[model samples]
Target: AQRVTQPEKLLSVFKGAPVELKCNYSYSGSPELFWYVQYSRQRLQLLLRHISRESIKGFTADLNKGETSFHLKKPFAQEEDSAMYYCALSRSPGGSYIPTFGRGTSLIVHP
Candidate 1:
């Protein structure tokens, strides 16, 4: 069975501190991994994708195939970055790709 694990349900950090949200997954074949964030009243938006190799709002995540993990990181945390973050996995259940998200981790950045 394919599964995504997020050990922490909530992470708190002070402004200007570095932060890292851990995510692990088990799956066969190539899987699409993404970090989605919902800020306050805003809709859930894509934060980063393993394939994109791009950083958003100072956040970056690297997909480590050997470790089977995609961990999101930021050099510094901001109060505005506080939000609910979810680690998602996309795999083909048949011909169509299906997205499965972890329970989610709420980040609280204090000034």
Candidate 2:
């Protein structure tokens, strides 16, 4: 079953708190994963990718094959970044782009 899973439906906490959004995936071939975020009515944008090994907006995600996870983490969450986060996986080749999205996690950074 090739799929992307985001376990938590809602994760609300105060600003400057540590945050982690869990993501898991199942794929047959080499897995390409990405994390997308939507900030309060804004369009969804790519946050980070496992292959790129980069962090965006103070967020980072790591791909775990054995555990089939790509969890998003941040040491100190900012109030402005409070938004909906989704874990996604792509099955297509060449890393061209197009990922299956999770239900999404709503992160509330309470000021």
Candidate 3:
């Protein structure tokens, strides 16, 4: 079984301040990590994937196998960046990939 955990249910930060959204996972086999964001009145979208190793909208997350963590970080957060962030874990077993999402973290960026 695979599980994703977002310890903080809500994160408040001021504009231009650094932001970190903690995410931890537990799985027996190698799994892929992804960060999804849902803005107000908008559908959920992919923010970043561990396999991509790229930054999107100034947010980046590195998969740490040693610690079983994939924490999302941004140097400067913006008001528009506020959204519901979710950590997801996916693994392909028997040729099927099943993804499990964490109880999303609501990011509130104050002006």
TM-score for candidate 2, please give it: 0.91
Q: Any residue pairs clashing in model 3, and if so which? A: none
Model 2 clashes, total count? 0
The candidate that wins on TM-score is 3
What are the per-model numbers of colliding residue pairs? 0, 0, 0
TM-score against truth, every candidate: 0.94, 0.91, 0.96
Query: 8-108, model 2: which lDDT tens digit per residue?
Result: 99999888999999998888788888888898768988899788999787888888889989999999988987889988888758655566889999988
Candidate 1 per-residue C-alpha lDDT over 1-111 given as tens digits, one digit per residue, 9 for 90 to 100: 678999899999999999999999999878899999999999999999898899899999999999999999999999999999999999854635778899999999999
lDDT of 3 by residue, 1-111 (tens): 789999999999999999999999999788888999999999999999999999999999999999999999999999999899999999955636888999999999999
Q: What is the lDDT of candidate 1?
A: 0.93
- Order candidates by lDDT, high to low: 3, 1, 2
lDDT: which candidate is best? 3
RMSD of each: 1.5, 1.9, 1.1
